[model samples]
Target: MIRKGSQILMEVLQEEGVETIFGYPGGVVIDIYDQLAKTDIRHILVRHEQGAVHAADGYARASGKVGVCLVTSGPGATNTVTGIASAYMDSIPLVVITGQVPTHLIGNDAFQEVDIVGITRPCTKHNYLVSSTAELARTVKEAFYLARSGRPGPVLVDIPKDVSNSEAEYRQLKDVKLKSYNPTYQPNIKQLRKVVELIRSAERPVVFAGGGVILSQASQELTEFARKTQIPVTTSLMGLGAFPGSDPLWLGMLGMHGTYRANMSIGACDLLVSIGVRFDDRVTGKTDVFAAQAKIVHIDIDPTSIRKNIPVAIPVVGDCKISLSQLNRLIDEIDLTDVPRKRQDWLGQIERWKGTNPLAYKQCDLIKPQFVVEKLYELTRGEAIITTEVGQNQMWAAQYYHFDRPGHFITSGGLGCMGFGLPAAIGAQVACPDKLVVDIAGDASIQMNIQEMATAVENCLPVKIVILNNNYLGMVRQWQELFYDKRYACTYMNHSPNFVKLAEAYGAVGLKATKPQEVESVLAEGLSLPQPVIMEFEVDKEENVYPMVPAGAPITEMLLA
Candidate 1:
């Protein structure tokens, strides 16, 4: 018996429990698409290759599964680069399958041919160019394994067109071993002891959780640990909802735009327990001064990330959920109820600084971005799944939106890629059909993925898109305003398309709101639509998100505008 490589690929995916795939069909990968059509696995046909990859990423982030994407070579594979890089930066598990020209056409400048392996080398955890049918099953299995394993990231498999058509005996290789790839989930006893000692001995202890908590499905463990110890917890931007934001012990995001209480708490803690967070510059601010007074205990699945940014007093390399559970069990017997409150007075003093001076805009004739977010929150009560594009809209969404559930807010936090909103909303809608799915995007970012409205209308997905129509690459403009004396060079956009017309063209409902009074009604109408809806808000151009921490400043040193 013989099997096509595409068949083998699909089998491997089924074995890995991939129920959905996001992708576009092209000449090089038509055979795979043919096989895909015959399978039970759901395939989302995106308008653009980039949208397909981001949609997969969103699916992975929202569902905590290994996202799968498929595409052809050359432009198709290249279009997925941004999305791959984005997932890599955020440590999301993604397996991308790209079709290349036939092996015989190598280096001939063949049509639709590109070296996807070379292009994705830096972005992917590992990539394989399958020249032989024998390697297809193992490579795909390894790709999935590497993708979802410790320190998860995107992995690429570039299969040639001929290879997809080639036949090979079906060999089910379970327990395939790779010598160079080893992921350990077990915590070191000595390191765990040191971390426990720190937790027991410290007067002021705080747990800084990151997206890793959600990635590891460790929220339960994280909350239990915090509750048992009565320790304060703070989260990074990507860490929102890792612990209930409304919980008494949980502090919201801690960064330049983070809540003042969260920032102050991180700065003032004597012992900082960082779980599943990489200490990104946004979270750390100035490395030298960031949690300068605190002894850090860094726990993560990726060993390389342990001391990459912040010096660790104790490094626990293991899965966040596993490590936190062990620590919680070991420290249950320690008595810390008598420890004097080291930062009680300091917290009182910082309360004035901890005031929630969130992003604000002047009374607007035009609907403002902040108002838009607030109204959306009011309508949905923050229960809906929210995705955001890059730039000012992303910041505004993060700044104004409050999430009550884990994995409700999905944004490109690490790579901060523009044009991420619409497709991500599509994926979220597909994942949870009952939840209200919205994409909060800037005019610029929205335009980049505007074509995805077709996917929504075609699928009748009922995704609500709120475009912050500032008519500028608003974030870059902010940087120019502050750093470059407001030159506003290429940041400005002009002569925009009537988004309503575009939506109508795509067979979706379209609405526009210029005034604040029109916002709630428009949002209500959009949400009620059975099919997809695009609402463009003519937002105030002058509105700016405040309390920004410049790129390298400590999270404590925020620029309040």
Candidate 2:
């Protein structure tokens, strides 16, 4: 059948099972928007192009589907760079569609024209510039295929305005075959045997899981492997929900701000089975001293990431779920009867570490940020889909609120973007309308994308916004207090807007809790509301996250509060 490039694009989106798209309309892509209006697919009109990408990212993470976003040329395309970088760093699958100037106007400094493909080349997994309407269908098919395949990352498809206006034969391309690209999903049997041998021989074994486990949907396999081997499990920030936080074998997050037991265990373990993790700087701390005592066995689908950070004893290159399933099957054949008894001493030591320096904050008359997170967790019964803006609020949410399942706790772990939470929560709520979605944000960070409250209100998404109002850029202030002789330069947010009134202005419910006594009541009221809400809590300005490892220091070397 013959169709316009714009119509073909919409049909391809429908073929890809895209129920919604987060985007901003512009002059170049007006044709595409006109076509979109006729489709059943929902388009979330965001305040900023960056929010569109972030909302798509959140939708992808929460729904375990590839996120789709669209924007016009020049600044519209440029604005998505930050969000694209964030998604790239974390391996989120996204297909960003950007409009381009007409083919005839190309390379002549046409109005609203920019080399977005070049700009996003470094950040995206792959990118394309569709030159004609004939290649549009194939290019889009390849774009989505590339976005979700291998080590999933964002992919951009820049369509010229003239292409969308032109007609073409509409062909639904299925089963994209790229001979150059094929991720190894099956693990080598010899490597599995070696890993099994390490598990059986080692008395102190620790299973370190990362975001890859969650991305691969291998949480069940990871949990089962850890349980069957009787090994203690710890995860990177992105790996929060891969293992149930309430499980006996589970240790809290491991890294700079990780729990004492988790940090100490990583440093002291004899065998470290790291899976689906890149051993990022935040998690490794001083790489020289990190896991010095452990003989590491790294398992990841990305071969380059296996030994890039820290040298590994056994490197298995395969998908997380596939590798874990094989490991489970191999272990089933092994003599693992004595595993628990052999690791008693190791488990006991971990318990002692947990008991001595448990994650805690002093109870005070002023509202504590940690207290707010804990209360929010309790009120929600740890079932809410939590997204977070980077800073003290993100760390506090990671530490206090335990996640028992995958896709529940979504945060920008790699890029540490500040304005991520609100838009992400908006997308997550859109993906899971029946679920309670909350954005744990800081006073300073919340303002970054506060305009998204209007998007939520307009969509009737009941996303809860919990702002830890500390009156400062809490993380930077903490670093300054510790290293810069308390010269809090430009960190104090003294002239911040009244968040309650801000939310009200956006046509959303607004609530505030000034004192400790008002925290729970305000939270209850805000949470119970059936509309978007901004619940701001006035917290202690000087409070810092505990068990923080200084930069370049070993993970074990923590500055406890």
Candidate 3:
């Protein structure tokens, strides 16, 4: 049927089953906005362009769906880079739509025009610039297809102003096929058998899982495989919630700021079965010494990620869930009874590591951030969907709050971007209205996108914010204190604004907890309210995240506080 490009775009979005879109309007995107207003596809008008992308990213992470965002040319599109890069690093699926100048203005230094597709080329998995109305529908289809497919990442579609205003024949594409872009979903049978053999033979084996396990919905298979084999499990930060945190086999997160037992288990295990992990520097610490004693078996959807960081004895390239499923089936054929006896002593040693002060903070008059997180987790009964801003607060939330299911804990793990928590909480609240959504934020990181408080208030999202107010950029300060002779350069935020007053000004509920005793009451009251609330907790300023593997140090080497 014949339609305007804007109408066709909306039709395509509806066809893709996009119930909501986060975006802002500008000159180039006015046509799409006009059409958007007339349709039922919910559009969240964010205060900033960056928040639009971050919100979409959050929705994707929380709901396991492809997040969608829209913005205009120049600065609007440029502002999405950080969020885009964050999604790219974390492998979150997102489809970011931006409007551009008319086709003739390409590369002419036109006002409000920038080559966003070119700029985001390095960050996005793929991008497209729709030059003609005829190509608009297909480009939109390709964008969503590429965004949600294997090894998911953000994809951008730049529609020019004239193209959206022009006429086009629209057709809903039931399927999108990229001839050159096929991802292997099934692991090679030989490789799968080798992995099973290694698991059966090793005396001490450990499973290291990452975001891919969650991305592929392989948590159940992961749990089953671990339980059946009687092997302890550890997770990278992004891999939290992929395995039940309360599970007896759980070793907590592994790497810098991870549990003592998890790091030590990975260090000492004879066989390391790594799934969906990228082996990033934060997780691997010193790569040469990482899993030195283990015969590593790396399984991932992306082939490039397999041997890129650390050498592996067996590399299985396939979907995490599918690969795990294959291994489980193959494992069924083996004499699995001996596996438990073989790894029993290994689990005992891990228990000893767990006994080594897993995580603790001295009780004092001031509120410790870990204590606050624990109380929050307790008050929520581990049910609240938790998002976090970057740095110490992020680490503390990961450590103290336990997640038993996938999609419960959301954070910018790979990019470690500040200002992610607030918008992410809003997105999660929007996606799951009945769930209590909280952003555990650092004082400095919270301020970065504090403007989104208005968006939450306007939408009546009832998203809660728990700011660990130490009056400093806590994480950077800790590094300075530890590594740089306490230089304390630009890390302090002692002059920060009153968060309670700021929350009130935004027409949202605000509360404060200055003493340790007030932490429980503050969390309960803040969570009790039905509206968007910001609860600021004054925490110990000098407290640092412990069990730290100093950058470039072996993962086994730690500085415990």
Which candidate number has the best lDDT? 2
Clashing pairs in 2: none
What candidate 1 gets wrong by more than 4 Å, as runs, is 339-352, 356-366
Q: Is candidate 2 or candidate 3 better by lDDT?
A: 2
Worst 10 residues of 1 by lDDT: 338-347
How would you encode candidate 3's per-residue C-alpha lDDT over 433-518 as one tens digit per residue?
89999999999999899999999999999999999999889889999999999999998886988888999999999999999999
- Backbone clash numbers for all candidates listed: 2, 0, 0
TM-scores for all candidates? 0.96, 0.99, 0.99
Is candidate 1 or 2 superior in TM-score?
Answer: 2
Q: What is the C-alpha lDDT of each candidate?
A: 0.86, 0.95, 0.93
lDDT of candidate 3 at residue 507, scale 0 to 100 = 100
Greater lDDT among 1 and 3 belongs to: 3
Candidate 2 lDDT, tens digit per residue, 1-561? 999999999989999999999999999999999999999999999999999999999999999999999999999999999999999999999999999999999899988989999999999999999999999999899888988877899999999999999999987887888889898878888998999998998988899999999999999999999999999999999999999999999989999899999999998999999999999999999999999999999999889898899999999999999999999999999888788889899999999999999999998999999999999999999999999999999999999999999999999999999999999999999999999999999999999998898899999999999999989999999999999999999999889898888898999989999999999999999999999999999999899999999988999999998
For candidate 3, the per-residue lDDT at 174 reads 82
* 385 Cα displacement, candidate 1 (Å): 0.9
Write down the worst ten-residue block by lDDT for model 3: 336-345
Q: How close is candidate 1 to the true structure, as a TM-score?
A: 0.96
Candidates ranked, most accurate by lDDT first: 2, 3, 1
